[model samples]
Target chain A: MTEHTVKSFDDELTHLSNTISRMGGLAEAQLAGALQALANRDSDLAVRIAASDAQVDVLEQDVQHFTVRLLALRQPVAADLRHIVAALKIASELERIADYAANVAKRSLVLNQQPAVKPVGAVINLGRLVQTILKDIMDAYVEQDVAKAIGVWNRDEEVDDLYTGLFRELITYMMEDPRTITACTHLMFMAKNIERIGDHATNIAETLHFLVVGTPLKGARPKGPSVEAQ
Target chain B: MTEHTVKSFDDELTHLSNTISRMGGLAEAQLAGALQALANRDSDLAVRIAASDAQVDVLEQDVQHFTVRLLALRQPVAADLRHIVAALKIASELERIADYAANVAKRSLVLNQQPAVKPVGAVINLGRLVQTILKDIMDAYVEQDVAKAIGVWNRDEEVDDLYTGLFRELITYMMEDPRTITACTHLMFMAKNIERIGDHATNIAETLHFLVVGTPLKGARPKGPSVEAQ
Candidate 1:
């Protein structure tokens, strides 16, 4: 490749990375908004957060199109190929994270209509934990900091531990007051949605691990006692 | 490109597609096994199904490695590029589907230890519906049948409807008999797992549509009233 073409290719790669970074930021804001909506019982904010998911989806499509164009025009190999593929994977992960946040918002819309359950605070805490992980994983991706990614990876169990505690607490709450069954059910799902978001964050961490280290994360994923185990 | 090189590229693509088809089949079997475990309350089958998810994960890794090789070596353009990317996306979706199935299986083990709940039958039915969608979507992928894929996409609402019904029934049962709250909570999550499996099937359908039509599926995803709305 000529110097001019190589420079253009580098520019395109940078552009693709920037698109992913932008998508990550949008997803983070979406989660934060959803958590705030849940905490404040702001149905209007929840509705808007649900709708804003489309922006993340569009950015994902941009990453897809940009990557395809780069691959075809540049035929980038080795590190460039891995970088492009990782961008696609990360974008998809971020898109799903946004989707989960939207789902949480949708559930919050319903939960707000019902009487407040005691476990809402716990669910929001879980969402906040997942939100921090989302931010850290994005930073890892942007800085190519494998340690930061590993930090996010190891924190998945903390989210799970909290989710398990929340799960048991919600079930106990429901068992205590049958009237709260309907509301607690939604809280349970909201908490589960946040837990799944944590899983996706771990996924992004693993993707970054492979992208930087050029090997799959070894051994079993560090796991706490699953909610199912409880 | 020389004839020999072109032939080898076609062979590589074919191999990749076959791996995806095999992965899809394994995912289907996993869901089926999970459903059967739930239906029969067979904890042994549940344990096996959960362990078998590792196999699907390994196949996904295979798909990832193969696609990277194809992209790096072939620098495939146009249809070939889309096909390779689609395979990666589909494999990831299948892996998630298997993970959901394993989750259901894990929940089943817990539920089996508890006294059987009355709504287990309804939950099994929901799983059956999702299992069928999984099969149809896999067929759509292996046959490259757009109509079949569309069929799978359109049926997502039916799965959601059934899941919503199951959710309500389980909640009602729990409200009536507080003794069953623990068991019912497990059933609620099991149904949710199956519903998520349906969503992944729709995801596969969309991926197939894009692979064949070279365009994203347009318009809103057809969704029934979500459980949260209930």
Candidate 2:
């Protein structure tokens, strides 16, 4: 490619990456807003979470357009293709994570109007752990920090522990007082969504591993969380 | 382009599609086997489920190889490029679902020697739900059936319902008997993985929507089951 074209492609690629990061930033806020809605019992904020998801949707479309344009123009090979591919994946995961947050927000809308069925200690803790991993995974993506990615992978265990505990707690709530079933159900999905978000964070970590080392990390086969999720 | 190259390109595309479908078939079986292991409490089947996931990994690599090669060779543009891209995504999701099955199997291994804490109705139900959706999504991709794809998207609700019920039931068990926590936790993850497998299926449906119509479908958004997860 000529210098002019190279400059153009580089600019576009940079812009694309920045846009996704911006979208990621938005998604992070969406997640926070969702959780905040639940903790604070803000239905208005919950609705906002659902409404704001459209922004991530638009960003995803924009990123895909740019990625395709880059492919046709840049014809990026090897690692370059990997970068675009990874970006596309990151976008999807980020988008889905946003949806998950929205789901949480929506559930919070319903659960808020009802009484607090259980103390939600374990659920809240898992959310914190997942939020940290999400931040770390995205930071790793931006900084290309393989170490941070590994750290994020390791953090999944904590989420698993929390999820397991939360599961037990919710089941108890239902068995003890069937009246709490509806509220606890929403809370449980929130927990599940947070856990899944952690899984995606791990996925991002795996992508980073593949991108840097050209092989998945040893003994770290993407085993489902060793803890039982039932 | 020469007619010869066009013919070869079409052939290659067909092969790519067929290869992905074959991989989908394998993944479907793996998911089914994982559930079978759960329902029948067959450790051997669980081991087999774990072992069978390798084929998916191999097939995923193979699909990527062919996709990369096809991109290099034909440099397909417009709709052709979209088809190839969707194929890549479908392969990735199918592979992940296969991994989820392996995860389910691995969890079964953890619980294999333990006494049955509860009947496997909800987990098995969720697994079957996922398997059906997985198969339909593949059919959606192969046949380019947007309606069928949309159906897969809608069916995610059932899987969500099962997961919610499973979690609640498990939670009840745990609350009543904390001793069952470890084994039931494994079962829950297995169920959660199956639910996520449903999410991946919905992703395939979304991809098919994009491929067929050049846009994502509205609604059928991912969500946590509002009822309860544990």
Candidate 3:
């Protein structure tokens, strides 16, 4: 390969990474905005948060096109091939994370109209933890830090635990005051959406682990089963 | 390229598709088993369904490894490249669909411990519809039938509509008889899990469309918002 062609290949690879990084940043901010809208009961902000998911969707498409072009043109092998594939998978994960956040925001709109349920604070707390996990996993992706990725993977259990506790609490609340069932059910799904975001973050962590180490993440994920069982 | 090498590549591609077809079959059966478990309150079948998800996970990993090797070795372009990528993405979707089925099965175990809820029949109906959608989409994938794929895509709205009605029915049932709150909540999540399976089937349908047409399915999805909003 000519030196000019090699240099151009590096530039294209970097462009693909940059597009994915930008997409990750957008997804993180979207989740943060969704959590804030839920906490403040700001229906207008929730509407905007839900609408902005389209931008993340577009970025995902950009990553897909760029990666396909890179694979076909560059024909990268070994580590480079792994990196490209990981980017593709991670972009899909981020898109779903953003979708879950939008679902949270949409549910928050309905939750806002009803009288406040007692467990709204717990829901917000769960969302905040997932938001932090998203930020940390994205950082791990950029840095290619396997240890940090493992740290993020392990912490999904904490999200699941919080979700299980909140799940029981919400059900008990509904049982005590059947009037609150409508609002509490919304809270239940909101918390479940947040829990799913944490799962996606863990998925990104595993993808990063494989990108750097060239092997699947060792052992089963820390998750046992769906929290709805508890 | 030598003719022998070309023939081997064709064989490899066929192997990849066959693996995915097997994975799809397993996922469909898993959902079928989960729905049966729910309908009969069969905890044993539910346990078996939950445990069987690991096989689907293994098949997904197989697709990932196979696709990566194909990309690095074959360096396919144009339609072949799209087919490989779509298989990777569709495998991920099938894996998630199976995970949702396992979740429904796990939740069924918990629901079985409690008294039966009135809306269990409605939840089973929703699951049956999604199960049919899953089967149809997989057929579309195997046959590469775009019209059939589009049919699967449009039918997601039916799943959403069923889920919305069931959501209200379950909530009203809980409100009317708070004693069934625990069981009804489980049914609500089971219904939501089936609804998400429909969404993933829609995703696979879109993936199949893109594989055949080299373009995304046009226009927005028929979905409006999270059913929790209603």
Give the range where candidate 2 chain A is weakest over 10 consecutive residues by summed lDDT: A221-230
Q: Write the per-residue lDDT of candidate 3 for residues A36-113, one digit (tens) a residue.
A: 998899999999999999999998988987887777667788888887888888999999889888888898898888
Docking category of candidate 2: incorrect
Error of 1 at A168 (Å): 0.7
Runs with alpha carbons beyond 4 Å of true place in candidate 2: A165-185, A209-230, B1-4, B103-119, B122-206, B209-230
DockQ (C-alpha) of model 1? 0.47
Ranking by TM-score: 3, 1, 2
Task: Name model 3 segments beyond 4 Å from true.
Answer: A226-230, B226-230
Residue A124's lDDT in candidate 1: 85
Q: How many residue pairs clash per model? A: 0, 15, 0
Q: With candidate 3 superimposed using the best TM-score fit, by how many Å does residue B203's alpha carbon deviate from the native?
A: 1.8
Error of 1 at A74 (Å): 2.6
TM-score of chain A of each: 0.96, 0.93, 0.97
Over the stretch A1-230, how does candidate 1's per-residue lDDT look in tens digits?
69998888888889888999999999999999999999999999998999898999999988987876676666677788889989988999899889888989999888887988778988988888898899999999999999999999999999888988888998899888999999998888888888888988999999999889988888788894363521
In terms of lDDT, the best-performing candidate is 3
lDDT of 2 by residue, A32-111 (tens): 88878777788899888878988999898888767766766566887777777678778878887887787788778778
